[model samples]
Target: MKLLLFVSLLAAAYAHGDCGGDCLKACRSCTCDLPNDGPSTDDGESPFQIGNKYSGDCKQLICKDHNASLIVDGKIYDRLVCFQGAWHFGYPEFLEEASSAMCLNPGNRTCPDDAEMRYEDDFKCMCKPDFEDMSDVFPDAPEDILPLCTNCGKKKLRITFLIDNSGSMASVIHEIKHFIGQLVKFLKVSETGNNIAVVSSAFSYDVLINWGEQSHDESAIHDAVDSIDADGQSYLATGLEAVKAALVQPTDENTQHKLVVFTDGSIKCGPEALKSLARAANNLEHLKVETFVVATNSRYTTRLHAIANGVEDNVFSISSEEDDEMENLKVAAKLQRRICA
Candidate 1:
């Protein structure tokens, strides 16, 4: 019985010794050289102590009974044994590579080669401009898993705005500008890789901004909008043709096109001219250019709907009461959803 007791004690000693000298050394030194701020303890202690945990960095460390353990994204680094006072797998080169790897959330998955990890509200893996997200295909997969992505070859978007700068629009021009400004903020034009153009439609059409001219310059785009002086008759056909020409400019074959028209309707043109506008709008449909219209006047809802390929939801109506800042904000939000969808 004494021999049996002695053997059991020897096994206990071996189990404790398994923690190794490096782990004990790491615990004693308590060095955590992570990218973010210096190490912090969960209990708000200045110096780390046993039962203390260092978190919020690339890697996590916890000092336990005379030993230290490395963790990442709630997963213990079982294979990474402590060296000196740092966590390392094997060689110094391997340690460097591991340190550089990004820690993504949902499931702490590594981003794909063609993707990059971005932080907005949380960490997200965004596919490169030329790649498409394939996460929808794996609906049953855990949310923590990294998204699957594939190269899309070429991805380009061209959006054109046709604003009716007619004599009648002068009353609500400020509301139109507000909507445009809010849309620009939501779109993040510079980051989305989209080219933007603006056309002012009066008796004649004016290309206020050309595609790819102010694509990345939000301030310049706003300046162009501010320069709009509402006057002349509303020539819808002229603006439609101008938009068509701008969208047809040479671009990638896979380029997606969008057209947004801000008008109070009140087309001063005759029936033949209106028919011509309808035909031009139809031509854009044939080219697969998504179209939307915002009617500043509720009375012109029918006219705006007709311009929007006869799609009722594609036309947004802003009543006189709804021209205020708060109301225009709601309208812009709805418009953003449709355009993005």
Candidate 2:
């Protein structure tokens, strides 16, 4: 009975020691040094020089001895690691030959012949395996344990303005400029890293502001918006194509993209062409279009809504007689909620 009890306690202790806690998710830096010949002190006479020390969470205190031995303590230890508020020597150390793995941040340091730097966590530098199933999201997991890493991609926002530059829009050009100024101000006040771009639709199309443009210089964008001239025919399809050309799908899996179209008068494209164009635009799963009709004329309202994916909330209209200040305020508020949300 006494022997059985002792064996049970030893097994329990062994099981508890097996918990290595969290492994390091990334590697910061590593170096190796050896001592040189001569009566040199430990200050600068190491044969192999210590490069930058590990600046990651798994920090270590190592001692280089007179015999050019590298270990945690001068001659007694391997590597000292602090785990669970207690220091354990030689238990968990940086993976050997780590340079052969796929290093995420391989700063000028060279790893062993075949080792490479791999992804990081919080414990030690792990190496990429010999073979991995790229389709498997957690391919790095050992057969006994669950996978530790998964990609949680980024989210991005893109805002685009499609404005009409036809002759009839001359009276409201100033109002458009003011609306743009307010929009820029709102973006600045919100402090979200949203992308901004502008497309002018008139006799010929021009992307005055390209996509991925930031809001750093408000004056430059304001000048571009204010410089729009009311001239030529309202070619809505032309402008839409220009916008499509300027757009790029972000590498991340998810994004929020908003395109606001402000146009007056009729589009130059025929019904068949308009229908084709609207279908193509709607097919873009990651992009949503919103229309702001500068006129209440029936000639453009129904057709314009089609371009806006036939969503009523996404379609807004403001006529020449409407109060410009109130209309701008409403539109700006709606935009803030939709784009910045």
Top TM-score: which candidate number? 1
- List model 1 lDDT by residue over 1-341, tens digit each: 64564464345334433343344443333244432122334454422222223221212233322232233433333333233445444333344223521122244445656566655445567766766555564344345444545442133457788899999999988778877886765444653566678889999998888866576578888999889999988888878977777656554558788899998888976788778878888988877888999887768665677788898888887654542555565566457556755
lDDT tens digits by residue: candidate 2, 1-341: 64564464345334433232232222111121122222334354422322115322233333334233232222223334333333334433222221111102223433221223332331222223532221233243233222222111111456677788887777877777776675555554212445667789877788887653333356767777888988887767667767766653432345456677766546666777677657645654334443443333446667777766666666655544445565554455445444443
lDDT for each candidate structure: 0.62, 0.49
Cα RMSD (angstroms) for every candidate in the order listed: 14.7, 20.0
Candidate that would win on lDDT: 1
Q: Return the clash pairs for model 1, or none.
A: 106-144, 107-144
User: How displaced is residue 149 in candidate 1, in Å?
Assistant: 23
TM-score of 1: 0.54
Instruction: Give the worst 10-residue stretch by lDDT in candidate 2.
Output: 95-104
